[model samples]
Target: MAETVKKATRESFGEALCELAEQNKDIVVFDADLAAATKTSIFQKANPDRFFDCGIAEGNMMGVAAGMAAAGKIPVAASFAMFATGRAFEQIRNSIAYPKLNVKIAGSHAGISTGEDGATHQCIEDIAIMRAIPNMVVLNPADHWEMKAATKAAIEYNGPVYIRLGRLAIDSFNDPETYSFELGKGITLHEGNDVTVIASGLVVNEALKAVKVLEAEGISARLINIHTIKPIDRDIVIKAAQETGRIITVEEHNVVGGLADAVCEVVTAECPVKVTRIGVQDEFGYSGPAWELLDAFKLTQPHIAQVIRDVVNEK
Candidate 1:
């Protein structure tokens, strides 16, 4: 939130953990041999006594975090998105989410933008995977300030939480002094009556850019940023559906069960509205440059604006 600063959300995750540890002694961090990549090394550098490295075993690391949580410690388990939400999903579902333990799971390098890591490493289905677990709070912060605030929110909340962090360095959009992050509420960045664009995670910035472009072209599309997916802001979504009449969802995740499905679920039962989704199709991402892969998948500002244009014209 400082003059168009650019930073990876994972970097914010680490620094937030370390800084928050200063005031809270119960905060303990566990890394799955990815201290450097997940950026938990930032916390390890300062809070060595409170940080634990659990080798490369993500499942074991989650189990240990659960145990620590059971002992009344605020344990945070860190790992790549693939391992944290994919490989160790069963443990997370049964151990942490079942009893609603106060454990924070930080899944870094999420989505197709994870770059050269390829399909195997890029986790585009983590939102679906984690949101399916009851009692789990799923958070996908858009920028540095949001990530910092979201991390603090997850820590202060006494329940299981899944915080998604991106590997791509994105520009900060929200101002720290003026921005306030509500757990389950969506922030309406721009309001219009034509159509609403509800976006989450890394693609929110692109959606904002597209909203401005569409307005310049005489289209009036509303922009809403949904950072919390599990308990998505139903009232905001319902109002947008009822007012705008149409909605477009964008995310850096799979369209099948990610943000698209979440938005559809709200309108399906609340206020039926037509919805179009923009995200990775039901296919694996191949190895490529991060920005190029996003462009190829049509997740950039121009592509988003084009989608908005097409959706509007279809009326």
Candidate 2:
């Protein structure tokens, strides 16, 4: 069998920006002095005139992006997730999301997988922060194809968008030829009745592996991939909760106000199932190897599989 391709979503975001630039002449890019790291330099190289490096000022870059959006251009402001969502919360809320401007915020190096940079740079809270603002659409694409399609979708949507890009390069779980990307729709990767596993972002592939492992062990576990966090797929979540009677959310984010919270909001209102969350426990990350951190945080396949077993056994 051929080896599966592994690529970081940040690389995909940069490539997506470059590919989507030709679709609209008004598409422009703004960076915060970390183009090479964020991979926005790809767009910069492709469209130098349209790409603007706003130095290390993420907040100022957001303000400029808002201004550019007001001037009838589609601006994609790129930076590390922490700086993009944390340092520029006011600008993002007041300038872009509040007015519902056509600005796409690409927050690269998101979550605990941003190794060695530690907690200060890793941004697991960005989803919660961005989703709280009115008119801000939150997206956390799982793989290269999803990020590519999401980039196009964000550019096409007529409002502010915040997309989390992962630093770790992961194996592609979705097939590019058949995969479809829809805004606010979660994909059911596997269907079962014993329990449901809802996942997003960098940990999705791990969740899929866990589900497969459960299937082999005679446990029928459902798997749902929630790429869009803000406008979560309530229908799928409700159906999973109603049919499976249990839901376990997994993400490379904090258990609070992230994928788990979103799923809980849907199921709690609609189906009221027993929901278990597997993610960071509202704690700061430490410097370590990226993959090692995933294992330490219990975000890998083995831990996820065990969690699924435990959730399935819950009576």
Candidate 3:
């Protein structure tokens, strides 16, 4: 395999926004004074007139985006995941989602990978919060290429969207030329029969690494990348449950109300199977290096592989 270049998803999102804006004149971007960190500066630089800096108020920025969307403009409001989802949730729920406006909420610096920003900045519950809103499409792209594709899709889709982006640069797993982005569809990266590993965002690469380890140990672990969390691909989850009998969910978010909850909801209704969730165990993160936090929270490749082995053994 060729060496994959590493890039942050936020960088790809910013670049994608610039490219999309060139094609769509109605696309406008709003930032809560974190343009540089969120990489929204790229769009601002490319299209100064279309970009709005709403200062440090995330709630106001969301409201502004909603207003823009209501007026027939495709507005993208972006900020840190914590503020984007937690601080301005009401605005998103009422001002955007309730009316089903065509606004894209891009939450950058998501998950424990925000490194050194601590629990206050890291957002483990954004997925749950955004997924709960009606008429909202939640997306968590795995890497640079996926982020670019997902961003373009979000702009084209005529509904409210919450896209989670990470600050940490990660290795590209999907080939940009061949990979296609479909809303609410799960992409199977590696096929297997012994067990299925469903992962999203930064943890998808870790899940891929774990699958390789399991493969060497004679465990056929299927890897599924779920970029679209809301309206999650139910058919894929059910098929995995029936074919594998055991599933492991890996994510960088809290185990509660996130990927684990989403997966269990599908399996319980259709096919009941033992599902092992690997993620932050309902605890707040502390200040630390991103990789260190991932290891401490038991979200690294080794931990995921061990969990898969344990789940398979239990089955």
Candidate 4:
């Protein structure tokens, strides 16, 4: 048998959407003229009658999705992260979140990996914006398996959902044949007592690598993958704090409202653990390679491991 190649987040969105459409006839897909880029075109190709093109108007597309949800249809509105989160934010909050509609907003080309397109196309603040909306379930899947599982989970889940996907090829984490992902659940990747690294999305891949680096340095680093941002796993974070004593958070998003902030909110209020957040520190990114941008923002594996060391030493 040939070895199976894992798909990227973009590929996961394509596969998941098509699979869900096969099971549910009332599932409709709407794209803001970026179907190809957002990977919603996969659904469009499979079910042309059920897919809609809302042109470049993301706000109107969001409203259309909310209306579809009201009529008992599951509508997935797809667009770029910046446009979906920044441009259609009002519609998402008012039309979708306000009513707690069963609509999934899949934002693609997120973070600096959208790259070369420059700062205007990137969305470092998406997590912050979506987290602020009441009744919104924010999810940033770390790999192909998680992304597909999240899309399936979103269908059964009611209310508004924001599922962020990346444009670049993402790393694989979970087993595609067996791993099951649940919303608001955190998966512990590695166990250790020296320090804990809590991360979500693309940064989780780097954190996993950091764990190997720490092992070579005679440090046992705990790795926790926080896939769901909203309704974050409190128990996992608290347990990490109690076990590791020191905690550091990593995310491709800004430190403000992303995984870092979400973990900090839990640890500070309950455990009061020594926590350090490794992410973009309230600054915009410049045009560069995805890895370069991560390095520039101090979100690389070395930076995360160093932060883990610092946080552990602080205690």
Candidate 1 residue runs with Cα over 4 Å from true position: none
TM-score of 4: 0.96
Return the candidate ranking by lDDT, descending. 1, 3, 2, 4
Clash number for each model: 0, 0, 0, 0
Residues 189-210 of candidate 4 have per-residue lDDT tens digits of 8888898888899888889988
Instruction: Give the worst 10-residue stretch by lDDT in candidate 1.
Output: 1-10
- Which scores better on lDDT, 3 or 4? 3
Of 2 and 4, the candidate ranking higher by lDDT: 2
The regions of model 3 sitting more than 4 angstroms off are 1-3
TM-score per model over all chains: 0.99, 0.98, 0.98, 0.96
Q: lDDT for every model?
A: 0.94, 0.91, 0.94, 0.88
The worst-scoring run of ten residues by lDDT in candidate 4 lies at: 1-10
lDDT of prediction 1:
0.94
lDDT of 1 by residue, 45-99 (tens): 9989999999989999999999999999999999999999988999999999999
Estimate, for each residue in 230-254, the C-alpha lDDT of model 2 and write its tens digit: 8998898998888989889999998
Please list the Cα RMSD from the true structure of every candidate, rounded to 1 decimal place.
Answer: 0.8, 1.2, 1.0, 1.6
| Top-lDDT candidate index | 1
